[model samples]
Target chain A: MTRKREFTNWIFGRELRDSRELEERPDEERAKPYVITPLGTRVRRVLFCGLVSQKNADESMTRVTVTDGTGNFYISAFNSDFGMQAKAMVDALEINDQVLVMGRVSSYQNEGKTYFNVNPEIAIKVDSVSMDYWRMKTLHIARRKIYAIRMARNRPGSTATDVKAAGYSDLEAESAMKAMEKYPDYDLQEFESAIAAQIQPAAKEEHKSSKDFILQYIQANDTDGRGCRYEDLLAASQNASISQNELDDLLNSLGSDGEIFEVSLKRYKVI
Target chain B: MSDQVKRLKISELVPGTQNVDILVSIVSLQRKELKNERGESVYYYGILGDDTGTISFTAWIFPPTVRIGDVVEIKKASVREYKGINRVYIDAGSEVIMHPGESMDVRRSYSQLKIKDLSTAQPYVTVEGRVSSVREKELERDGKKTMMYYGDLDDDTGKIRISSFDKPLKEGSFIRMEGAKVSEYNGRLRMTLGSRTEVTEIKPSFQVGERLYDIHDISSPLGGVTVNGFIVSLGPKSGLVMRCSACNNRLDDIHCPDHPEAPVAYDLFAYFTLDDGTGSIQCTGGKAALLGHLGFTPEEYTPENKTISRRLVSSRLQEKLLGRAVVIEGDVTRNQSGTSVRISSLNYVDTDFMKKLEARMGADFQ
Candidate 1:
């Protein structure tokens, strides 16, 4: 099963109890059953409901500490190891806010103290429940309109406001706007597709040229000892004669070819 | 001409040659300093030597990544006279290649020889000398401790001090020397050793006394002389002291009480005045270390007793040694204050040499 699906299933079946009842149990007793339980014992997969206590960034790792009143544990993401998923986790966190972390439990010993560590497979902002559910359902239709407008703006000579005037709603337009902020070197169509893939995974097949164009540009300019710069490629596209849809298709194709690598957000270089 | 001409060992290369290429084993390495006509510091050079001979090479274009024992092929290099001494300089436009593991036929160079044969060389001979005076000097260049030392030795016939190393030799106590291209210092002749000078104490039959000699008297053809004199005054005028601001305890910088952001002060002025009847002058800094070897401590002149003022001590000591007859050997420097002489090794003169001098002077002395 997919990791996300497993996490959702665990959350649906876990035995829920009041937070106070869990806290009253002695620490030794609480951890004993979890450790000695044979692997054959139906493994208990559960979702932890907790308040975000701390967030730390060190080099390439981001660790978030969460306290569920009964205990506190850490959720670590090595951004170098899991790029997009790690970034998504960092973007969704807010200190003191409540969150639902779904993962497997493992014990760790550090400085002679034993603590439980959670390798979270899924995380969601608890406050966005009812509102976020409806938003996800209607998101696809709205995103398509936004994608069309972004593609239009990305045309060689088109202005950004020209896409807004073509009838994209403010929030839909703002989603593309925020994606541009995250990927400054991305052309409007590439930005739209990257965000679209996150919100609607099937949309990846819909836009392929944006990735191919980036790959071709990186290969052409990477001959000099120095690697190609992302901004230079984006600027080149602005001056190229290609249509927006064709450019989008090119970038996606290049990503699959592995001729170019994303060194940083919006920063692409020849591998 | 045959394209496969036999390669010449570095020692076999004639002193005067243009575009000579040779493969040689590095016998020693010594660091060197040179200034351009504009007084701008240009290169920190080194000397590389083989059993055949030694050559001076400049490290201006690249940092020296080569060590003392690496064998390298010097291609299209040239030999030239630097300040009247024969030395080798690599051509700037030439390509110098280094081979990490290639072996070449070995031949001992002149600088690699012992004091026995060094004495027979007619007039000018290149030889390695042991360090007799190493003083750490703090200057305002890179805010680092620079060490300057005078090495003294007898090439069997004479002794001289080779000025070397702006950085302290913080490693082995014994310094190995090589590639000392002979030159003149003041009116007396001396030699300047380079970085490629080999410093090792593993040779058989090595005796410190056999090689020790007075740098000044070496050129005079005078054999052995010793001097005994009283210390009139002593301290380092250009000496260094590091003190912690918090507790005022003397520190080694690493353990300052204030630490990290603590303020530590470095004082660089101390001197000592000594007299041996014939002459006396101020000795400062590492020169003062010699006094400690003779039995004196920094606490002797502390302010509590106030027996001697710092300035008075220096001056009185200087005057007391003004005309005392004493035997001493080492390097001497003439500075603005007076003539500063560092005594590398000393002993009292016996009555023999004195009686000989008295007999030569005849009845006029009586």
Candidate 2:
């Protein structure tokens, strides 16, 4: 049987890195093999947005690290005829730039330690709005799996339909069941805590003040019709003694809270 | 304000629950001004959630200080079913107290259903299907003429009518529409595209494929349907018939009153009840659709055997179709009598395929 194209799974770096098992279809040639994550995410293609942390290019290949605050995703684009497009995209990207990449996951075994990286099929430079949107969507997806797994663990011998009846999509329910069967001893609490801490950092009075300042700055400076630029916010944050990481986090949190809307790429508007 | 009221989780909410108290964080918030018969008033609507689940909420009197992601406790909230989904309503009688510094992760789930599974019960829905047809018309609203496009969309499961005002949809495009408003009109499910609805053209990993529907799921009258079932019984009119060559209408007698001089055409009409275990439907077809299955060729038909053809065709149809598993791809139509499928293509399911099909349907129905 001819295998069809696989869906691009929207996943975060944490879960993607946590995936350990790769399943292959030996019976069907040209079938896209997939990895089953500890959370039961059966993914072959993945779509994610993150900040480019590192880049190394050579005649043979281009390697880059993309981090989504939670963890890092290693992407390798081979400089070959079949991988020319991916290599060009990786070559064009710069460190600290936000980018969205959809790619196939490939795993290799070295010294008995299996490692995984993405082979990009499509890559585009995105802005904070797109980045934040991807973050929120991926976070919600992750949370749903967590909840489904928890439900499955709570109800012994529960089927996928039972989990689906608890208000989960069939895909999520099936994935949870698969995860339970494959990772029977996986620590749910530890994974949940780590994800939650990364998604929602502890609130502080200074952070609150900075958020207020960011909102006000956008409102006041968005007068030229084109929303407030990322550079303007960066300058404003620097003047207010807010670090780059804190500013990014504040922007993401504000975007997630629906207080600030990104009108365009790297432009903020108070909604 | 509500010391006696019982605090309930969002998941615990049911329809017609009165004087309910709950604490939840606002996951989504939207402020809207409504101008109605009573006059203009501002209200807030959004989704609220606890650790358990999420519920849509409406607040006629809400604090401006509270925004999305703020945890708040409500006293005297009422739960009511609106558009088939339970919603929490906060009116003047309700008091909302904000709890700053606290947060909650909202668990939101959307029903993933095919076109056939859609109902008005799901107010907002996301569906993926191919646009089967498109009809454009102009509508006058508030003295302004706006174009509205109405059409049908179908997937492997079934088909449904879709209409969009001001939003034009192209035919034959495989699109995924998110947050479309589902409504019912004259016993038909219709999905309307509103401003909030998001439409995206997607390249499906798998083939968009043919329209395959269970007998039970055939509600809307549509085309391009593939139904699998056993021919249980034949209709009274399931035999050979004479059609007026001019208009192609079936003639009750040998002579056509209107086109008396025109020659009559010999046509084989077969009507049967197709039962696929879940349900049954009346199906109709003509000689072109049934000749091969009936083991007859057009060359064999002549005016000489017109009298004997009826019995031969009836028995042949029964012999070839009755009590046998078959597949019919056709169009569904509704009239005063009921719903029936006009067969365009018919095929008998092989024994091996029938076994696999039964296994699949058994799993599906389970």
Candidate 3:
């Protein structure tokens, strides 16, 4: 079999319409007729076909980003919807995978750059990217989008219905609901800034110091050698610029990752 | 058997009688104090009088459970001295018997007595007079409800104050009074209407026109005057001893057997140092029993004589006395210390003036 035939089989079916044949037809008669503008505006309905760009997974959420030549957008899936069915879809998306994204076109302006956004209400990956990569990337984009909406709607006066209607995950909707109750005048921008300022730095530093500390502490003394107490760890981390809450988060991450085990209440030991 | 002294009238007897056996009608009986076994106390004393004279008496053993106006025969009662004044005392050893056969008509005792003739007798006598004024006051004394009605009465000879307890007599009404003891207060002869003093209003035979007076009207001209003032301070030394708690007898000493180191019960009294700011007087009397009846415990402000000094009398008593005009008939004497005037017999002027004042003051008086 010829490579062209293989490519054709991979893309479509046995009988395919040629590009010239589509060009020979009138604009209204074209199979996929759309316009892309440089100013982040698409005049006609456009099809975004690409492999998964990135994937990120956390305990609470998963996120995925998809990109074609024109622009890129994200989708998020929360733990509440991270069932086997959603996981299966997440498993299928991969980096560099060829996918067909069909959704409504939406736009957002940030930092003076207008970004064309498509909410991929539907997605189909092709043979170019692995199923695993696609799944992870979809999950990653879904989590990011979920987190963004959650952070946004946590501002004062934002309601759950508003967040949900803006296409946020259920977990995001729930968090926004609770935050709205607490600070009814919360500003969405302020909340997003706070989360960014809080989470980003810790997430960066935690990977290095926390992992090294756990490994060294476990190696020098057997799991119980010094009896890892939360208070003791807190004391050790006191000199750091990080806040108590951030340090606690790192410790939690370590515990969940099985690098340490909580031998007693608030006391940790190496796993 | 000295021929029973020829059935002597109380008027014929000496001013002080010792070991005198006499038959006399009890004009009034009041609760007084005596000591009991275990050195506790008891109440068995009161004023007993007849048509001729009246004296305070004490029953040493059993209390005489008798009412006012009862005729009683004292077989061998002896006179004793109290505070330099002589009083009669009867005991179980004395043949003190209540005689129903010798009943005396209470009203007839005052039937012939006129308000003007009362001054001639050495001993105080009752007189029927018309109430020219009546004043009713609602008061709370030591947490107990007490209403005092003070009024002036005139029998065309002179005017005297008629004070009713807990009730107000109608103004312009005539009332017959009996067993009212007389004393001098604030330089004026005053009569005290005790618990047994009977007061009943009757239709006046002649109407007395309304008389107008102010606080300044309480001069020497109104021989018996009624005035009111707020009680500023009270003291305990104003009256006699009180009954002991355990014994219920008047305690003469500071200590009692049950409470050997301290007196169990104390006779409390109030000396109202009152002022309208224009003038002031001090009214001292046995106030403990009255205060106790009104629900107050004696509080000692100073240690001397266990006296309650400079105390604020209850608001009810204050309201009853303060800012009102009263009529007092007795000798008005300047206190020996020359600090204030003392009116021994003080009563409210009456309700007629009070009603007019109330009308002028509008609802604020209420």
Please write out the lDDT profile of model 3 over residues A38-72, one tens digit for every residue: 11111222233343656776765556665431123
10 residues in a row with least lDDT, candidate 1 chain B: B214-223
In model 2, where do residues sit more than 4 Å from their true spots?
A1-271, B1-16, B19-112, B133-151, B163-167, B179-198, B205-207, B210-226, B241-250, B254-268, B277-281, B286-288, B295-309, B330-344, B355-366
Assess candidate 1 and give its TM-score to the true structure: 0.29
Q: What lDDT score belongs to each candidate, Candidate 1 first?
A: 0.44, 0.75, 0.46
Candidate whose lDDT is highest = 2
Q: Can you give the TM-score per candidate against the true fold?
A: 0.29, 0.38, 0.24
DockQ of model 1, rounded to 2 decimals: 0.00
Candidate 2, residues B265-296: lDDT per residue as tens digits? Answer: 88888888775533578898988889887766
DockQ for all models: 0.00, 0.01, 0.00
lDDT of 1 at B180: 49
lDDT of 3 at A25: 18
How well does chain B match by TM-score in each candidate?
Answer: 0.41, 0.56, 0.34
User: Could you give candidate 1's per-residue lDDT for residues B219-245 as a string of tens digits?
Assistant: 232222232333333343423445665
Per-model fnat list? 0.00, 0.00, 0.00
